[model samples]
Target: MEAFERARLNAYFARLAAQFTTPERPAAFLITHLLPERPAFVRAVATQTDLRAVLPKPKSIHAAARREVERVTQCDPLSRDLFENDETALDYIEARAADTPLVLLDVGGYFAPVLDALCDRFSGRILGVVEDTENGHKRYADCDKLPCPVVSVARSPLKDPEDFLVGQSVVFSTEALMRGRGDIMHGRPALVIGFGKLGSSIARLLHAKGVQVTVHDIDPVRRTQALAQGFTVARDREAALTGAGLVLCATGAVSLRGDDFPHLRNGAYIATVTSSEDELDLGGLPDVYTRTPDGDHVTRYQTTGHYFYLLNGGNAVNFLHGASVGPFIYLVQAEILAGVRMLARGDLGSGMHDVGADDRAFIAATWLNYFNR
Candidate 1:
């Protein structure tokens, strides 16, 4: 990353860290993707309160991120701080900080296990949590009772624009991946398995490429919106899967199960847009088909006489290339910082909370002023 770009990131993050502060802040445990832009945010958090640890997502770790993380951690990074597995993170935090008061910053629901295990012993020690992704938001929401406040920017309007850009990147990366294999997306039939903000963007962007787009959303409201938007709604999912040359899982849930595999077209390509690895039953693929390594990011699965390709080892294809949103991601990152300040205050009750309107406006205005300049 350029020094100028790094300065820009720190500049924006500095504004948020300055805007939100509490007299007494809680010690923080952060879980985020190890991307180029991460170090700036990490430094921004340090300016406010105690930063106990940083746990990078396994799938999103890149060489640039490693260098940045090393410098950010002063080159003496903790072995427990750079975990790739969710369980390892849960175990470390649960063991080390079960008695220490903590505020958690989570992405992709890696902290969900901690929330589930929040019994009496862990309750007083955990001040609050800030969640970043839809998958993580859902995981926290599903918790029977949260002992502390959990704020999420997952569905906030501040995150909507970023999601659209992310949708574009998903297509951009996938097409780039496929182009490497001598495949063209134009005029090909594609099926998108979700109609949320991200999924809707994917559908529209796919249509823009002249690909016949079919959407399958379990939610009736989402399906209605997709149909009204002039995309084909898959009333017969099997038939849709059978005809689709490409299938993208956008739902954070298990979109493709064991039984759903037999319906796919031979030589079809599969990918996920969501951060959740559970979007597809990856283990179930090898159960029913012969799994073969196909290239850098491609995996071939032979189903009897027919076979299909999976991209990025069933993870988000956007991660194949670094999942950087350039400066647009700062809008949401700002909200996360604001969330950190909120958690430090310890005012809100236990449950999932949305980003405050003030935080949203500050970021939107910050983004507009900087970009428009």
Candidate 2:
């Protein structure tokens, strides 16, 4: 290993040990690296002590990973994106939104500019907007000022439904998977595995796109709800992988079994919207990996391999990229953006699926403008 790489690895493990000793295991984290190259062995190392290990060295992975991890763990960055070029960010966001009205499940605070712009341009035309938080009900109740309505189990839905639709209210969930982290919802072939708040929203959007959707969660009730929403429901994780162009693991569970992905066909993609990449053992797969802007360090186990392509190593797909527009703001952006997509596609009129490209671009642009402003 290079001198800097060795030093970085040492520092990373040391930090992990320190964190293990703390009363709280960081539920989520954003690791930034100053190293120029990604270490070949970018894998999750969780000891029996529960210390999560990551080499937040300088590289493409760390740079893009900052926003998602920081939001959930409440861990602040050592520095800020002081020199972030809005133009480039805008271009990137626009490009991603160009041809697709993606149903994004913004988890654990993964919202960025691209999402915001999509909403601003195509208000009321996006697909379903859903959010999951520790105190989803309370979060929605406390929302006095926001672009959308807050939806929560604790509150009465008889009130203005539109308020929550725009995220005037927010949902807070205290699930271990979230561990107080947040995420963003973008891209395509999105299949959020769990049918909790996050999974439902993703399913709703994808369904609108006329995309075949499937949802698998431990809860049979959620699976039933997904089925009602015109989504294919899989009772088993492995069953969910069948005919899925993309597999989005959002169960927030640790350690995904290899058998769950046995049928992952050639060119199939799997994005992780969870907490760690350690869940899936990609070494068993037969695909190559790729990296995203969010530092997910994706290893695509192509069909040539025995496994599947792992997006963000099954970590929070949002965290695999970059920047927090702040926690609540991030979720709000996600909700609105997805809502806008629904509106643009006329999905809401039928109370079903629809997503539009213009709306997608608008949300991305608006959020980008909001973040930099």
Candidate 3:
């Protein structure tokens, strides 16, 4: 990391430590999908209050991250296995919260079950939950009421940094994949579904690379935005899928499935820039005609005469191919850390909320200064 970037991170964490240490520090439970900045964030949280327990997503914990988590939780006796599923995760949270009021520091909405469990068990004892993904925000959106406030860093302006990073990684990975397969993207038509932050970024990158990009989004506003950016907006799903050389899914909702198979051009590649579940209906697809693992990061799926390529098994391709979000992830992590403090301090209402504008401005300005300097 650059000197200014590191300084900004430390400064932000120090501010969080100051805000959360006074009055009375609440026990914090961190459930995260491990990322480059997570260990540092965990260490920072520990400096302000008790980090009660950690539950990391399965396959997310690495040697370094596990070591950091162990270092932080060595004092806590209730630490358990890395949870593989929601049921087990809920059990762990319920067991741990039997004695203490807890704050949830979450990524990928992994602690959503904890929030549900708290509603029936701990009730008012929950400090709050800080969520870091749009998928997570949607997961809890339908809930009539939440036991505590939810501060969503995913909905904040800090997401611009994440979008830029994601776009770069996606473009890098996609180009490498095409080149390795003896193909080129220039002059090829590509369809990008979902014009949200990540999707929009991916579409822009594709356009810049000389690919003829057509975007299909359910949201009228997003379609308008894509049109303004000089990309064709597809009016029909089948028309978008037909004859496209590359089809990228960016909607954090299911948009592609087996039913759409007939519309796909033969040899067309399907990949996702967002969550796998959000874009592809894998279960709805026919049995794989052939499966070949391209090392451990990619898989090729064939059905009948057509083949669909999945980058990183339809998960965030950027993470698998180009490292997770690159160094810019620290900026998003900083916003999350700020949300953690906001949740701990209280006064926000129950329901999903964006990171405060002041906090968002601080993070953005810090990053801009680092880049400009």
Candidate 4:
């Protein structure tokens, strides 16, 4: 079997290459989590054009995926073309001049600093950047101006289905995590922080699994929505945290912190669904509690009568199982690929935009055709 042979299993990639990629496209830069699908996406992009490099998300980049990507892109074993983090990728890309536009495809806004630099310093055409996560979009949202238009699939309707499935994956992985530890999470009191798109789905899945689920969101509207859906919303956060046997952080922005650590129920198991360690602030944990390592990916934080288990440290727990999003990841990946095509037109100007309706239709139709066939 060849490197991209795995990629060919999903017809979507070849189709994506046909529709969005062309030989004339500018050099592509990819900022992504190197899951099993990454090499597949890379192979697809490489099919019709060339890539400048592939930069893996610093923490979550899998070793196997890296090797496969190196193989798929045919990078010399010692080549500097593959990068492991933002800082390194930036160092390489910032040296270019504005002679030609650079195409960016990023996840979690990993290349925000590069984009910001392009706005003024680099003087190159950042043809555009395609952002895949909501928090990633937020990183670019604050800037009043940009060097090039950014097309975001993070907020598009195309992403809604994936959001629901991501919640399912997170809960399913949480359940799997427990089962691996010779335990089950059913009937346990679970507290889910954040009730937005992903949070709401995680809460509901936990509830359906027979776990007594409580939800907390900073937004009053979200809290009310949880209540309307028959989930518990405690009068205060401390109370909710103190009762949960399983605490899951869904809000990509604010999930947990060291100060909130003491509030967790004794013997509780906690996890998060964010891409990075930002979801749960771990720097505060040691100051508040004595820690004990509980084998792989498990840390026990406790003092006196208080104790809780933090799973996978503080990163997305589902990823521990590999290809965590399964085939459904294609939905978001496909939209992101389309964003690359749109930016090539050089018409969106210097602002953030969504994948247009026509593009969405093509993606949806292609997706249905792939599945139905």
The best candidate by lDDT is 1
Candidate 4 per-residue lDDT, tens place, 325-346, comes to 5556777888877888788777
Residue-by-residue lDDT tens digits, candidate 2, 297-361:
44545333554445545545453223222322332323332333233343243222222345435
Q: Residues 188-252, candidate 3, lDDT per residue (tens digit)?
A: 79999888888888898888888999999999998999999999999888988996988888777
TM-scores for all candidates: the values are: 0.91, 0.38, 0.85, 0.88
Instruction: Tell me the spans in candidate 1 whose CA falls farther than 4 Å from its real position.
Output: 74-91
Poorest 10 consecutive residues of model 2 by lDDT? Answer: 167-176
Q: Give the C-alpha lDDT of model 4.
A: 0.76
Error of 1 at 276 (Å): 6.6
> 323 in model 3: Cα distance from truth in Å?
3.4
Please list the residue runs of candidate 2 whose C-alpha ends up more than 4 Å from where it truly belongs after superposition.
Answer: 1-191, 235-237, 277-298, 302-307, 320-327, 330-373
Give candidate 4 regions above 4 Å deviation: 1-11, 74-90, 95-99
Candidate with more favorable, higher lDDT: 1 or 2 = 1
lDDT for residue 89 in candidate 4, whole number 0-100: 49
User: Candidate 2, residue 212: CA error in Å?
Assistant: 0.9
| Cα displacement (Å) at residue 356, model 1 | 1.7
Task: Arrange candidates by TM-score, descending.
Answer: 1, 4, 3, 2
Model 1 vs truth, CA RMSD: 3.0
- RMSD of candidates 1 onward, in order: 3.0, 21.0, 3.8, 3.8
